[model samples]
Target chain A: MDRTIAIDVSHLSKTYDSYRAVDDLSFQVYAGEIFGLLGPNGAGKSTTLRTLITLLHPTSGAATVMGYDTVRDADKVRTLIGYVPQERAIDRFLTGREHLQLLGALYHLTKEEAAKRIAKLLTLVELEAHADRPAKTYSGGMKRKLDIACGLLPDPKVLFLDEPTLGLDVQSRLRIWEYVRMLKARGMTIVMTTNYLDEADQLCDRLAIIDGGKIKTLGSPVELKIALGGDIVSLTLKETDRIHSLESELKDRPAIKAVRATTKGLDIRVESPEKALPTILESANRLGCNIEFIQYNRPRLDDVFIAHTGRAITESIPESETA
Target chain B: MAHYWQEISALTMRWVRRLSREKFSMLFTLVQPMLFWLIFFGNLFQRAADTQVMQAPNYISFLAAGVVVMTVLNNGLAGGVDLLFDKENGFLERLMSTPIHRTSVILSRFIFVMGITSMQVLVILGVAYLFGVQPATGILGVAMIVLIGMMFGIGLTAISMAMAFSVKSHGDFFSVLGFLSLPMIFLSSALVPLTAMPGWMSFLAQFNPMTWAIDAVRPLILSGWTEALPHVGMVVLVMLVFDALCLYGGAKAFRRAMG
Candidate 1:
C-alpha cells in the first residue's frame, strides 16, 4: 500500500483450462529495488511477469504497477513499464540502431530524445560498436543486449526482465548484470524472473522462491540465508569407511544441526560451524577417523530454497522444462 | 485516434524496412509468377481464340486480368507468413507487450500486403500494355482492376493472418497454404475461364470467390465500363462480406494467441 511500491500483486491467479500456473500469489516491489521471482520452469515466474506487464489478463484478484491497475488501466500501465521476454525480439534484418529507433517511435518519443536515449543505451550495453550491424550478424549475447535496449527505449518506470540472460555465456551474462545495475542506479524498479539460483543471489535485492504455483518464501538474499538458521560445514576426509557413523555421531550432538556425507568428505549444516567443528574434530580423533580438510560457509539462497520448497531448486524440475 | 494511426504507421514502417532488404521475397512473390503467366501461358494459349477457350479480345488481355488477381492472391496469402515467423520468434510477443493498440499490429500487416499487391498489379499491367493489350476502360479501368485486386487481397490476407495466429507451427501453416493455395488458384480460373471449364468445375467455380473477382476485372481490361459495371458491383459486395468475416475471425484468433 505504500506509495513507494512499484508493483503490487495480490492473490493473482492464472489458469490454462484445469492446470493453474500462478495461484494466490501476492508481493510488493518497492521503487528502485531489484526484485526477483525465483523458480524453476512451470513455477509461475514468467506468468506473474506477464500478468504484471499486461500481456496476459489474470483470471482472479488484483494487480497494479505504480498505482495503475493492470487490467483496467492496461494502456497506461503499458507506458509505465518495459519488458524483455526470454526470447530475443530483434528483427534479424534490421540493424540494432534501427530496432531501437522503431521501438522509440512506438513509445512516441521525439527524434532528439530517442537519439539521446539510444546513444546512452548502446553505450550502457556496450553495443555501440555493433549498433549499425544487422542484428542477425551479432552474437547471441549482443542480440539479447539489443532486446534489453529495445525494452529500455521508453525509459519505463518498471522494467521486467524475464530470463534476460538466459542462454548466454558467463561473460555475456555478467554484461547484462552490469546493464541492470546501471538501470537500478538510475532509480528504475526492476522485476526479474530467473531459474538460475546464482543469478538470483548475485543480482536480486529481494527474491521470492516459488514452487507449485505458490510462493514458498520471500526475502532478501542475506535475510533468507540468515532465516535458514544454519551454517554449512563441508569436510574432506582421508577415509570413507566411517563416514556414515561419523555423520550420525555429529548429528546426535546438539551443535551439529544436520550432516550428510559428500563424495570427498562430509557436508554438514549446523547452528554454528565454529562451535560444532571442535567437537567433530575430537570425535574424529577418538574414533580414528582420518580427515583431509574441513571448511565452513554461510547458507546460500539455494539452501534457503531447498529448506522452504522441500527440494533442491535445481532438482525441482528438469532443465529442459525450465528453459 | 491520432495516436492509434501513429502506432499503426510505426509498425507498418517496421515491415517496410525489413521487406526492403529481402530481394528474394520482393521478386518471387510479385514478379516470377506474373512473368510465367504472361510469357508461357499467354504464348501457349495465343491461338486458343479459335477454340473459344477464353472470352476476351485476345489471350493476352484475358490472361492479364487473371495474372493481376493471382498476384493479389499470392501476396496476400503469403504475407501472414512474416507474421507467423515474428510470432514464433518472439517479436510479436514483444510488440503486444508495448503500449500501442493491438489492432495496429494487424492493420500494419494489412497495409504491408496491400502496398506490395498494388505495386505488383501495376507492374503486371505495365507489362501487358507493352505486349499490346490496352484496357477499353482506360485509366479508370486500371483503377477498377486495382480496386478489385485489393478488395480480394484484403480477405485472403486476413484469413492467412488468422491461420498464422491459430496454427502451432510453420510446418502446419505451410501444409494449410499448400492445400488451399493451389486449389484456390486452379479452381477459380486464375489460369482458365469458367465457361471454358467442364460443367462440374464451372459449377464449383461459381462459389469460388476468385471467379467473381476475375469475372469482374476481365471486362475492364478488354471491353469497357458498360459490360464491367454490373459484375464490379456484385464482386465488391461479395468481397466486402468476405473481408468482414475474415477480419473478425482473425481478430478473435489473435486475441486467443495473446492469451
Candidate 2:
C-alpha cells in the first residue's frame, strides 16, 4: 500500500554557537508508519527530532510536519503532533488524573470531551486503577504511561518521541513498545529516536541510521540488511600474522562486499553466510593465520551501521546519555 | 476553555491545586517567614509606642503596612520557583509545545500570586485589627493597602520569573534569591521608619519599590487620604514603570529559553 508522506525534512541544520548538533540532515516519514531515527548518543537524532517537533528551530533548511512548516507554522504544526521527550515530564505532585485533565484543558477540549478522553487514555495506559493517585507513587513504567497520555491529549496525527525508552527498564520499554505499536495500528504516524538497535529493528518499519548529523543509511530493517548484504563473520587470529593477507583475499571474493579489521579479528561481510564460511576458513588456513576463535552472526542493524560508518556502534547507552 | 479568561483561570487553577495538595509547604510559606517580624519585632519595639519614634499610636500599627509588603515580598520573590521547576521537569517545554497562548502562562502566575497574597494580607490586617489598630480611612483604606501590595508584588514576581528563565540552574536562582530578598526587605521601611534609618539607607529606600508601596499603604492606615494620596499616586506611577520593565525582560528571557 502506498502511503502519503507525514513529515518532510530537507537539509535541516541546528547549531549551538560553535557546536553543530544537527548538520544538513534530512529524512521523510510516511503516514501511519513508525519511522525511527537510529543512532548512538549525540548522533544528532534528538536534535533532528526536536527540530521536527518545533522545540528547537533549525539553523538552516526547512521541515514540514503534516504539510505545515515547522518554523513558520509552528502553532499549526503543534496542533497536529504530540511530543514525548526523553525525560520524565510528569509533575509528581499532581495526580495521574490531574495530569491528563490539565493537558485536556491546554488542548481546549470541552469539559465533557476532556473527561471522556482522559478516562479512555487512563484505561488505555492501564493506569485507570491509580488515576487519582499522585504520580510520585507510580512505578517508572506507570509514570511513563502518564507522560504518553499527556502527549496524546490532542489526538495528533503525527507523534514525536525522542528517546522514549532511553532510561526505561525492560518491562517499561516493552509496555511502551506495545503502546507505540497500538498507536501505529490506530493510524498515528510515530517518529521516534532510539539508541537501542533492537528497538529500531522491532518497532520501526523504516529507519534512518544517523551519525555526525548525516544519514549514513536509510531503509526498512530487511531492506537495509539486504542492501548491505550478508552475514557478519568475525574471526580472531592467534596473532596479527597474515591477517592483512586474509582481509585482502576476503574482499576479493564475490560474496564478500566489505571487510574491516576489528580489535579482536576481521569483520567480513558475506552475501551468504553458509556459502562463504567454508571458503573463509580455507582462505584463513591458506594464509597460515591460526584462528583462535570464530563467530558467525546474523546481520543486524549494528552490522549495517558498521558497514556504512566503518566503526561499531558502542552499545553502552547510559554513559553516552550522561555525556 | 475556548474563552481567553477561561484558559487563564484554568491554568491558574493548576498552581492552586498543586499548592492545596502540599498543605504543609503552603502553610509554612505563608506563615513562618513573617512570624518573626510580626510577633518578635512588634514586641521588641513596644517601647516606641509611648515615644514620638513613629507617627502611629503603637508600634504594631506602625508595623502594619510593613507586614502587608512583607507578605507580598515572600510571595513574589518565590514566585519563579514553580516556573524553574517546570523548566527542569520539562513541563514548561510541554506547555509551550501546546496551542495555548504564551501570555497566559505569565498572567496566570500573576493571578495566582496575587490571590495568595490577598489571603495573607487579610490575615495580617485581621491580626492588626485585633490589636486595636483600625485604618483611618476605614474599609476603603484597607482596600487601597491591598492594591499597593499587589502592584509591588507583580513587579517582584516578574523579576523572579525573569531570573528563573535566565539562570543556568536552581542553585543559581536561589543564590540570587538570597542575595536580593533580605537586602530589599531591609532597605525598605518594612522594619523601621524612613526617618529612623541612617541617611544612606534612607536615600536608598527612596528608590526601592517596596518602600514606596509600604509608605503609600502606611498613611492610609494611620492618617487617611489627606496624607496618603500623594504617596499612593507616586507608588502607582513607579509600579507601572516597574511592571513594564520587568515584564519586558521576563518575556525576553522566556522567549530566549524557549528558543
lDDT of 1 by residue, A1-323 (tens): 45488889999998877778889999999999999999988898888888998888998988999999999999999999888988888799999999888787778787899899999999877899999988989999989988998889888999999998889999999989988998999999999999899999999999999887899999999999998898987788888878887888788788887676766778778888778889889989887888888787888887788778766666746422221
TM-score for each model: 0.90, 0.91
Model 2 segments more than 4 A misplaced: A236-266, A271-290, A315-323, B48-51
Residues A1-323 of candidate 2 have per-residue lDDT tens digits of 67799999999988876677788887889999999998888888888887887878888999999899988999899889898877888888889998888777777888899999988988999999999998889988888888899889889999888788877899989999999999999999999998888999999999999887789989999999888767888899887866777888888787676788876679888878888888898888888889999888878888888777667777433322211
Alpha-carbon lDDT, every model: 0.86, 0.85
Question: Residue A216 lDDT in model 2?
Answer: 91
A4 Cα displacement, candidate 2 (Å)? 1.1
Please tell me which predicted candidate would have the highest DockQ against the true structure: 1
Q: Could you tell me the TM-score of chain A in candidate 2?
A: 0.90
- The native-contact fractions of the candidates, in order shown, are 0.77, 0.65
What is the overall TM-score of model 1 with all chains considered together?
0.90
Q: What is the C-alpha RMSD of each candidate to the true structure, in Å?
A: 3.3, 3.1
DockQ for candidate 1: 0.66
Give the lDDT of residue B121 in candidate 2: 87
Span of ten consecutive residues with least summed lDDT in model 2 chain A: A314-323
lDDT (tens digit, per residue) of candidate 2 on B22-136: 9998888667567567767877888845448687788888898898898898889888889999888788778878877767888899999898888888888887787787889
For every prediction, compared with the true complex, DockQ reads 0.66, 0.60
lDDT at A140, model 1 = 95
